[model samples]
Target: MLKLFRSAASIAALILGIAGVFLVLYAWRLPPFTGTVQTTDNAYVRGQVTIISPQLAGYLAEVAVQDFQHVKAGQVLVKIDDRIFEQKLQQAKATLASQQAALANSEQKRRSDEARIASSKAQVDSAKAALTAAEANWKRIEPLLERGVTTQSQADQARASLDQATAALHQADAAEEVARQDLTSTLVNRQSLEAAVQSAEAAVHLAEIDLQNTRIVAPQDGRLGEVGARVGQYVAAGTQLMALVPEKVWVIANFKETQLAGMKVGQPVTFTVDALQHAELTGHIERFSPAAGSEFSVLRADNATGNFTKVAQRVPVRIAIDPNQPLAERLAPGMSVIVSADTSTAASDVPATGTAPGATPPAQVSEQ
Candidate 1:
């Protein structure tokens, strides 16, 4: 009876061992996976904060905004001592007025020159008519002198009168030519003065722009932060006086290179920030860095050394959150967030059978 019992026990042990082996083999055939990267207690929120500075240097006169104040776009943030700017603007206006007057005077002078030219042309015509009459008189006297009907003295006087009239006519013609040249030159001078007036006007416009800039205004609607300037402070150009935090904010997650295998653009991402434990925000993967984080470092690691050990790289992935969240629950930039993207969505979104351009068709199942 003891030998029979030992044989039955041996058979039972063999059957149990075979069953365990089969279970191990079955578990090995499942899909591969790894533990997700996450953090429950550590993270930071971050976003873009614009540095508020003056484009022009001046003494700060009035600080229009208080610390941590909310401001709308184009609201006056600060007022520099605009006294100097105002004086400059006044001086520019005065200069432009002066230039405009000069231009008007130049135009008036040009008109006067034109009038002189017209009068000169009339005088030239009168002189030409007088010369013609004198020549005819001299011709009639020549016929008389040839017939001895006119005395030599009379003929000589007539010739002298004709010469005098010719000289006067030539003088008038020269005067007319001078007047015409003067008119042309005056027109040119008027055009030049007009150009000067235009230039002066441009200077005035620039001065006005500068004056407007003296009243510093917010470029966008944002929250005020880090108010470093005070009333009566002398701020230089490009000096930072405060900071403006915009309402828009999002998260940047650095994921392990191995974790990105299933990560893809447009994948749905769920994030948890340490500060707001109860707040769950949904975002989508916008993009991932093409290169590893180490590659972008100033001194990248050289793996050429034979003694070097391999390390998995981490890549930066940008995830944008839904914009429809409540104002109270909006995420601020630089806030740490634990991110998880579901790449399995690609399976349903992608066509299973149709082949995309430049891609091979997916495998089709066959009924066996």
Candidate 2:
């Protein structure tokens, strides 16, 4: 009975020893999981796509580009029927020429008016000199008639001649005033003609701008898409004809409000595209949405209905890609990607090999 008790004691001791060892091993292997982050697979590669539209309405004469083709900035992509535009331009030029001629004619008329005014002034001076000489003769004859050395009829004749010369001088002065008034009126007319010329010149400038718009060109280096117009198709002003997607790409991550505690601008991020396997990319948190994504939507949730249930909201985080990667002109808009961001690290600690795999250590995470 003592041997049986000893055996049972040994079994109990063995079990206790095993339990202690297991505890020690577990304590050594366990990691400090301060926090567990959640992630989502919903992410995409995006960029600015320029929508090509016409500035003037016309039938398309030719399409100089094809779908999915690469194009450079200022490269002509289409041509509109310029016949009407060219005609309009010619008409404007003709109108401008006519206006210029009218302006020149107005200047010439002003000169003629000045000449008439000068001639009238000269006549007034000549008449004044004649009247002075006749008055001098009459003054001498009146004294002689009173002394009886000159006849009364001769003296009266001299007086009448002086009076006629005075009247002629007055008429010459009035004619001179009339000529000055005419010159002033002509200048006013010239100004009105000058204004008309200015209006015609403005129309000419507009016609020139319209003529330039007949040829369309790409605004930046991008991939062409959605080319809807064809040769001989009449397109109106502001009509969308094609789209150009820029080569540069970025990721738009919709992160929940709770996860944004440490997520700040300039934090590093690692990403993988579903379209391009074996390819990884790196980026930084450029900015966070100012408000929840729903707040910016067309129909925001109304929690004011009184039956309120608390729910986490998401905000869009923009992540700019590192330019050193072998992006190779392959990144396009709306491409699906899996993004993982590291909000714990500083911008300076992040290596330039940001795009390198195995650089950012993955965090202990949960699925969102």
Candidate 3:
């Protein structure tokens, strides 16, 4: 009986050992493994942060927002002193009015010139008729004097009358020429007046735009950061006054290059936030970085010219937080997170955000 019990115990021990090995293999995605998951501690919550600035320089007359206040889009945030800008706008309006008046007068003058030209043409016609009569009279007087039918004094008087008529006709022609020139000149001057009016209108528009800039407003719905602006403080254009963090936030997990062999977009991800007492959160893989994180560093590694050692690189993977989850709604940026991805085949997949474009964008560098 003791020998039979020992044989049974040996068989049971062998079976237990085989089961343990199978469980280990399953966790690592080896052959005969039923489950597969990849996890990484190198992850954190991130989101878009908008920096607020001014478009015009002025003394701040009012700071309407308090520090860390939640503001809606188009809400009043800051106010600049608009006394000068208002005056400029009024001045522009007055200038525009004056130009309009000048333009009207020019057009009226042009009309008057046209009428005068017509009168001058009538005078020219009368002068031509008078000139023809004077020439005929002078010819008749000369023939009569030559035939002795008229006296020398009579002929002299007739010649003098003809000369007077000729001078009168010349004067009329000169007056008509002067009128034509005046009409042409008036037409040309009207164009200059039109140009002046357009210029004044542009000035008025610019003044109005500047006045509107005095009242600064929020660009989107977000929570305000530290409000450094104060009433009576003089601020310059493009001065940073505050920051805005939007409500939407997500995470980026940096996984080892070797671990990305079978990872893909739309894979379900599980994460825990360190700030929230390690509260578990779920998401899906949105996209992957085009290159390793080190490639974007300010001082890139140059293995071609120096002693080098190959090291496993980390590639950032974007994860879109499931908006329906309560925890996702409460999550904020800058929180540390531990993320894991299910890399199993033939498993239910999570819906995915679209993949990123193939080309990488240039990194932005700022001094402060």
Give the best candidate by lDDT: 3
lDDT of 1 at 169: 88
Q: In model 1, what is the error at residue 15, expressed in angstroms?
A: 22
Superposing all C-alpha atoms, what RMSD in Å does each candidate have to the true structure? Answer: 8.3, 8.6, 6.8
Return whichever of 1 and 3 wins on TM-score: 1
Whole-model lDDT per candidate = 0.75, 0.80, 0.84
Model 3 deviation from the true structure expressed as Cα RMSD, one decimal place: 6.8
Candidate 2 structure lDDT: 0.80
- Which sections of candidate 1 miss by over 4 Å? 1-31, 35-44, 290-309, 347-368
TM-scores for candidates 1 onward, in order: 0.80, 0.82, 0.77
Top-TM-score candidate index: 2
**Angstrom error at residue 174, model 3:** 4.2
lDDT of 3 by residue, 113-179 (tens): 8888788888878877877887888899899999999999999988887888788788888888888
What is the per-residue lDDT of model 1 for residues 40-152, given as tens digits with 9 covering 90 to 100?
Answer: 22234556798999978889999988888989999999988988888989999999899899888887888888888888888889888888988999999999999999999
For candidate 1, what is the TM-score?
0.80
